[model samples]
Target: MKKVVELRCGSVDYFGIGAINRFEGIMEQYRKRGITRAGIVTGKNSYRLSGAWDVVKPVLDKTTMEYIHFDGITPNPTVDQIDEAVNLLKDIEPQLIIGIGGGSAIDASKVVAVLLKNTGKTARDIYTGRFKPFEALPTVSINLTHGTGSEVDRYAVATIPEEYDKSGAAADCMYPEYAIDDPGLMLSLPGKEVLYTSLDALNHLVEAATTKLSSPYTVMLAKEGISLIHRWLPRALNDPADLEARYWLLYASVLGGIAIDCAVVHITHPLEHTLSAFRPELEHGFGLTILLPSVIRAIYPAAGRTLSEILKPVVPNLKGTPEEAEEAASALKDWIGGLGVTQGLSDVGFSEDDLPELLKYLRKSQGESGSLSLAPLPVTDELIIRIYRESL
Candidate 1:
């Protein structure tokens, strides 16, 4: 007899090559739900560049609904920025919040919505696990970038500038009420942005599949996401106008997000978070690209078989052998390099002199156990330092 598996995603979702055209329908749903006022959260430029803002503006203009726009968000959003958005949102008291752009903007919108409903609670409280909201203002995530899966999951991330700490926060209320994944909106993304964002999605799949909480269902999603990226990312890069490639990459990112939601991410995420926390200039995906192969090499002894198996779908002609881990890691590194992202930590403005500061942030974020709980190997501080050094 064969075993059975159940798969479900909690949020209402819409995906199509040109699904962005349905934005007006989403607005109608919000109105039907008795939402009279809406808040739109997005980056300063992405929504405009992608023409999403133009499409949205007319919809809002024609409707009776009152709306406010918050476009101050930046990449690697800080807790302080969330507080700023929250302060503004509380004033308008919208019934619904719409998050647009990439992960940073979407994440900011989620945290801001939570703080708005649960007044008097700060982002610091959420980041430190002191305040967990039971309810948040309804949210709709409109994805303009195929990265971070923030559009579909309950997980939201923020950084503390003072402590240089970056962490994830989860609450039942944090999940968006609806997700809009339109590959057409992603067409305007710069080549480097596409590369970095796709890499982030790939990292999400890899980390989710390798985590201890991984199950057959989540692993299947991870493998499919990896395969999609391996096949389409390069093609998307080669021809940005290829709607077919863009559609599949966006689909892969959704799978990656769903996989992480079910299985959680591992060390690579925390390490990259620390790196970006210290060096805010470093894009999250770029940092992951630099560190991924090194981290894979570090953990191969403990998780070689599993890593090898999981990677076979993405790595062509991968043999099911003891050396599979090494081959997979090498292939992945070559792929990343082929995409023209071969920068090391030093190349990105890190030095041995900065190691102590970076280490401090890493220790504070991951704590004594480091990322060992999620990693297959015993991830010691020494090993982490070695990985950083090797990445450099």
Candidate 2:
């Protein structure tokens, strides 16, 4: 019997690898369509490194276009920051928005694009389960990192301070009108960030492939992403100058994002967001690395037979029926451990005391979180606490 599921996403045009340098060339296309003014949303670090500011300055200078820059976005952008970015957008009144940099900057850009229209409610109101922001401006993304496929998804997560929840307000409105994936920008990425973002890509693949909601298309994307990550992550790590490896990783990263768009990520991200939000000292990739093994152990047992088959390609050692797939699932943890991050919470500055607080936060957060809801087994507050304790 053929299973069925509905697949839907906002329109996005993807220009991969070397297309970044052609920003001037593409601006005419958008301009011809009346997108004269654009808001440039980028990370201070990425904008500087990718020469994005320089590339666009010439284009903006030539046209009736104007740009406003908001560089305050951080990894796992918070609700407060999105409000600020949206306020900036309202003042700029851009016809379009160009998001440059990593997932955080891109995610913030998605939020800001929509929040421009909603003067009545705050972005915080939208993020904290208070309201949903369904309207957004056209957004374009120039991706500089290989993780957090925020360029392709309508989803954007922001941590709400008052609610103490890392919820997101998602609508097709948040999806970028176009995503420019130029590996050329990735050439200058810091070694540590490259490593962490690749790890982030790997996490995205694992969660998407293993999620209960994973469909055939999502599985295919996940498998390809995992395979590419497995092959290219180390090469990029070993030869940081290898543009080929970086390019492949970037493609893999997009595949991971596509996988998530189809499958919907599970709770691991929200869980990691909880920790990352509270402890900005801890890197986002490092937090996921620490939490992944425990998360996999919790979810693997409950994943579908189709998921087990999907894993077979990425993790080729498992053979036999779906029931027997559990044996193969154990190998996933080992595979993740090999990816340059093998440490516990304590190793990353977390301790026993953090467990109770993190669990409390997780339990109180909403049900749609990619990590908790997708677990093969039903997750409870106790399970999250136990995982944290074990991770520590």
Candidate 3:
């Protein structure tokens, strides 16, 4: 049996099978500091359903930590939703915040933690980088899913439904004070939840490994994450209760999050944000998986060597040359398709007609901590259209 590992990136991560047990000590230490009031963020059912709340609630109660629970974080968290969360917590003036669930809940918590401190700032202020946050309430991220890496990173994404704007904001103040990543909490996940979240982690490694901003450290992190996901995602899917599989994937996902935190993702994430924002029902990982092949094709001229090397677990023997970009792209497409996510943009309710507005929302958020510019190749409107059309 592998022992739990404690790592400190942006937060102290207690990682392994029984990692949630660390939460008690975390709560006790925080209570010693006299920071007891907490504004908790979570998806409606996930906190309790994932078994994190059972472990956490007792700890909070034991420490006399009064908390106002906001179990309202939704998939692809919206600006309006975050604003509502801020309104709910304004009176409580929580000295600390707890985000339970996957990336969406944690990302929302990061935003709310800052908003509670910079009382006048809204989602708009942070997402657009119109104003930067210098301080935020300390945060504790109890990550339930093996994807999104929101537990350890300082980036948070929120969408504006009315404007079709989904923007990511990064700041030093947004890092959580503590994070708990226990695979035991992930056993209750449904099959599709397991599948999509694994793909989300895979895509994180994919984009982080290939982007122009990638470094040896980023590639090393992305490589291990990609290999771990390749090995464990299928096992976990076959047996949802596979604790060992869940453990590795959870570790890989944290590596993905840390890799992207150091460098960042390319066109896929930015465009997926637009797609899911345009069609609110669309899942973020499914959208990213669909765009992966097309985006890989666009980036392979520059990133082919690293991508080919990292993807060898699935792609087998391959010369990491610009010439085999199509082959690499096709292998990834088939691999993701085999896993049951065979949807294109049009299949998910996007059309060329929507492209105009999609690009509009995309351009609006560009150059504000923009990932498009960091892509291996220049991201032109023509190339962007081609990638979308190919994904469709």
Whole-model Cα lDDT per candidate? 0.82, 0.73, 0.86
Candidate 1: stretches off by over 4 Å? 1-8, 317-324, 366-372
- TM-score, model 3 to reference: 0.96
Model 2, global lDDT: 0.73
Per-residue alpha-carbon lDDT of model 2 for 1-392, expressed as tens digits?
26565364554645555576567666777888888778877766777777666776777788668788788888767778877777776676787888888888888888778777666677666765677777777888888888778787777777776555766557767888888787878878888788888878877877777666767777677777777877888888888889899888988888777777777777577778788767765677778777776675566556645445656645665543545444554566576666566677888777888887877776677734545676556777778887788678
Better of 1 and 2 by TM-score: 1
- The sequence of per-residue lDDT tens digits that candidate 3 reaches over residues 39-129 is 9999999899999988889888888988898889998899878989999987778999999998899999999999999888898877666
lDDT string, candidate 1, 217-309, tens digits:
777887788888888998999999988898999998999888878777777888888889887878998898899988887766666655666
Question: TM-score per candidate, in order?
Answer: 0.94, 0.91, 0.96
Candidate ordering by TM-score (highest first) = 3, 1, 2
